[model samples]
Target: MRRSVLVAVMAIVSTVAAGCSSDPTDPAPTTSAASASPSGKPTDISFLVYGAPAEVKAYRSMVKQYDVDHPGVKVHLVEVSSADAALRRLRKGEVPDVFLMSRRDLGEIVDAGINQPIDELLDSRGVDFTDLYKRDSIRAFSHSDRLECMPYGISPMVMYYNTNLVDFSEMAEAGLDVPKNHATWTFDQFAEAARFGARRGAKGVYVDPSLSGLAPFVYSGGGSLFDDDRDPKRLDLASDGSLEALTTSLELLRKGAITPTPRELRSTSALDLFKAGKLAMMAGFRTLTPELRRTPGLSFDVMPMPALPDDRTLGDASGLCISAKAVNTSAAADFVVHAIGKDAVSDVAAAGYMVPANTEVAESDAFLQQDRMPAHAYVFNRSVKDIVTLPLIESWPALERAVHGDVYQLFYSRVIDIEALTKKIDEESKAVLSPPKASVTPSPSASASGKN
Candidate 1:
């Protein structure tokens, strides 16, 4: 359901965008002016990245290569585990020349007003936007016609099923064939499969209590989390289609189809449960592919998450942003371009840790080839067009927490009342979206005058 943004969980930067061109054909990269120092003067620029030790090491290695190409520039590598932490560093006046982060963090970053628009910088460097590998990736990171960041990954949610546990036998018995492909599965058919598998003693599904997990369900039911995406004051979770979707999902838990109720799985992860062979199916992003590959004796494969007729899959992206306050803006811009360049993308794709934002790397045989279980590695890329972008708003984090918190409370309590729960969530969300009261207890002079 929800992919952990944490470095260790998926070994990917949190967030993703819609999929791009089906054609993986490599194209010539945009020519950018070299980071040649006219004076041949040495410069030190800071680069901030998130993830585990391995990711940090890999970035350092990549930077070393960049240094060789641009001898006058030196990159000081800084590591942090999450976006909030990076923002904290920025608040403390430790702004990096460039920093890699999730697109979801853009709202907060914009609020902090520390990032510079990349258009002027890109133009100055002669990097044609069209020449970039993934056009959709770039579009996903842009807001209000402003190119705020350069994308690095296009992570989309997909379904992972334990081949050994899913009810293939029951499918045959019921004269119901298992979906031949990701696109073939429907919500009704999916439910039938889950019900059949549950009867055969398999736990049907489990999802995290996060926006990523809930968004698909809402969209499938012809509802959205926001009433009006452009208006930060509008959150529309408690409604018709979303209500129906929420009801159906909760009923599965009540019927013992989905295991480890939200409360029960407080500490245990859905991924761990699936890897241990206890789950029949669960939803996750592409990074799950690598983790599932490394686990022993797990016969797992991925498919697109089953959806209703109107549903669109959720996709988010993350990339690099230059600090508006960066002292070495030119060098920072050059470093970001180099980091997501074609060669870097090839290495990233080969590692199988993430789907590269570069179209060439993502579509290339190296990324498409599967020595791993999910023979349908292309599902992530193929599902790009169907992606539903979460609204960009400063209050998104608050709204997400509000929605998830109330939903889980209802799920664990076995309330099974969709209308009531939705109403409650709607009420709470309204409070978040509403402007704060002015808190006027009369001016101090007025108060004194009135008292007298």
Candidate 2:
């Protein structure tokens, strides 16, 4: 009887093993389609993006095309008004399969454990990082020696001048030194241009009262924003090089006769003033091009940021990132590859706000838009070489907030103490740069005896 029971158990085990074995004739499963549900339902993934109306429209169109191209997958497009709003959503624990992120926010995003490294995935997807995209842009999204996101847009700040207000040809004829190349100019030449444009009841120029607005000048003057670029401990704005740069920039930026008066600024924004033909020059990025073109009577042109003995400028870089908790990472990565592809990037470039990281499309007419207002559109492309991206640090946003008032005072106040102001900026920055460690709480037993 015992032998008979053993035989029956052995037979049942063999049967179960055979049932679990795969059929030799069955097709292999594909990684790209692995996201499909067990019930054979199509995979669904979400893509979060934020931009202007036209830019949002372009992203929607891309999603629509991607959905059509891949019948087995559906992409849900989520539009936010701005990058800050998107970051808020992420902080609230709303994780999209894929999202657009500013490179500046990479440090914080990584610290939050929300983004996944995609270097191997991108390689598996056949993305040609070296040949297809800008090296600097790619580096902007890398952390811990791994690619955290795929770079999309790289826009360097440039000076946008009203053609009707500041006529370069006329300035040249009047014996004022004008930039012969139009893409390069010295600090003195920039000051002269500003003085010349201060006419027809218009302000000469307006540089934003913020760190980003002043960083390029600091860098070009052989100054550093931080004590150390890679692992910064404090702001170095009071250093000799930085002070010299600030002094030169302030000469033109602080002139009440040239820049918009405080009362005027409170009423009308510098951009609107420029549109109304009441402001001659302003510092802006590529995204401003499309809006300027659409302005009824606004004729504008662009130039590289004025150099302080060096060609340097700040750039805003953004990229596509995959969520660490994505339900379908394979599908999400596929969408990222699609989004940065030549055709997809081209469509957005045509909208005029994106300075595509895709080298091929950046050189195409889609971005240049020869018929547009900024006849010197090439300046945007050329300025890429001069772009100096800020270090990736989690405390950057808070640091900027801490120094905002001081920076504003430095730019706007008529009588100020430069040394004291810069020194204060450094001290305030230290609090964010190296926040104090949290104190340990005493246990009940230890507290009773006042000892551990």
Candidate 3:
């Protein structure tokens, strides 16, 4: 009875899964493929995608163009608000033929048995893995000695500062040290800038109250996120290097006079505050660019995360995956190959949010729109060299959730015990990272006492 109820809920969710379309004048989407073409029967395959409206529009445009370029292949686009939502559909057995997924989530998706190994399929489609995509990105999607997905976007975390609030020219005039190179700065310089920006009712900066938000700084200071990189048993935030990094970062990040107050943050997000010019800076990936561009009166530019003597940052890599349950595997493979090709990736890159894994597109005007707000767009391309990708672990999402509150407290709480807090965080993480083994059940024959 419970199973039937779940099926009914999923059926309803599937009906509305076509999501928003790029063009309002376009006809309503059909769950199935369009009627057979005159020349031959068309193969219908559904694709699941998620991103901002503009990014989604870019994908919709890509699908429209793909249909025009390849006859007798109809690609249905499925839009969801987030990766979690897409995973929900897959977990409910509503797997689409093809989907876009984050490399970090590869372990979870693979464990769920929804995604298929696509190395052979991609090779069959003539994809030049070495020449086409970024090397680290390709390695990010490999699991169990096979490529699980085709690398799409490889975005590293960068500092987005309001030019008006954190003026380099003003800093130099005031005798504060400015970066000799605009692409890089030191942690001490970053602190000075934050203090400089904290003036005239504007806060200096805001890093997200999560592990992902703090990772770049930790790693830049020569710290590790896990006790074991290959098979992490617990978080390593309490280790010597990691603790030192966090201690240094929190000194600046936790300054009440230079950051948003808890009450203010509860009322409005750091991103919204930054958009309103009430905040000086924040750390984000390429996806923040499009929305920031849309905000009026906001002048912003990108820079590498402040180096702790070493240039290091976190990365977000996404890829295209084919469903193990897909009926039209060949059709899906064709679409995946075409989607990552130069033209399709360029269309998406033009949207101003993606740092394409495609080598050509990464270096093209499509990504580095020289005319755009971020004059130093090359920072993104350069920062890729310093990205420290998190290890693929099935319980990553859960681990993050378990320690989120502690991480937030470590960043925002007054009078925090750094050592105690980090130790507690490591302990909490183990519950998710290395859960206890389940007890074995005894056989009935072994347990029997000759009594029924």
lDDT digits (tens) for residues 304-403 of candidate 3: 9999878999888888999998977777877786788777899999999889988789999999999988888889988987887666677567888999
In angstroms, the error of model 3 at 304 is 0.9
Candidate 2 residue-wise lDDT, 1-452, digit = tens? 00000112223223222322132112122257434567778799999999999999999999999888777888999999988998889889897999998877778788888999876666656566665566677667776556778889999999999988899899989988988886799988888889999997988998998888899999999998987777777899999999889888887899999999878899999999999999999999998888888899888999999989898998988899999999988888778878887788999889999898888888989888887768888888899879886776665678889899999999888899998999999888887776677899999988999865
Compared with the true structure, what per-residue lDDT tens digits does model 1 show for residues 244-301? Answer: 7767665664554556655446666777777888677888877677778889998876
Query: Which ranges of candidate 3 are over 4 A from the true structure?
Result: 1-40, 441-444, 449-452
Residue 447: error of model 1 in Å?
9.5
Residue 437, model 3: lDDT of 84
Clash number for candidate 3:
0
Worst 10 residues of 3 by lDDT: 1-10
Highest lDDT: which candidate?
2
Total clashing residue pairs per candidate?
7, 0, 0
- Residue 266, candidate 1: Cα error in Å is 5.1
Top-TM-score structure, candidate number: 2
CA lDDT, candidate 2, residue 232: 73
Q: What lDDT does the true structure give each of the candidates?
A: 0.67, 0.82, 0.82
Error of 2 at 174 (Å): 1.0
